[model samples]
Target: MTPRPGVREYVRLIALGRPPVGWRTTDVTTWSLARLAGRLIDRLVVPRMSRGTLRRILREGKVS
Candidate 1:
């Protein structure tokens, strides 16, 4: 199955440290500092995640 669009775009944008032209933001949802921080945590702190596991965490992270 294909990956979630935003999540895949997010990973690429982060790896590049800037969004490509096609990834331009709109009025409804602009990328922000907090979002970058969250992505960093997702990439660095979260364990290697399969699509199913990632979706689970996206829904509710490590509930304890």
Candidate 2:
């Protein structure tokens, strides 16, 4: 699977004043400080989910 871009990349893309093609913003206040913190949490959770999925696949011979 392709790696998802991290929060830093997302910030840089927004800083450029143009979100990359296909970008979607779920939060209404994309530039808010709160959004940054929320994204940080999201970044942390995503890796754990990926690792869990990988472990499941390896141990069970298929992802659950």
Question: Which numbered prediction scores highest in lDDT against the true structure?
Answer: 1
TM-score of 2: 0.26
- Cα lDDT of model 2 by residue, 2-57, tens digit: 22546334444433343223334553433333343344345563333334333333
Query: Which ten contiguous residues of candidate 2 have the minimum total lDDT?
Result: 55-64
Error of 1 at 45 (Å): 9.8
lDDT of 2 at 8: 35
lDDT of 1 by residue, 2-54 (tens): 34556545444454454334443343243344453455455574334354544
Highest TM-score among the candidates is held by which one? 1
lDDT of 1: 0.44
Off by over 4 Å in 1: 18-47, 50-64
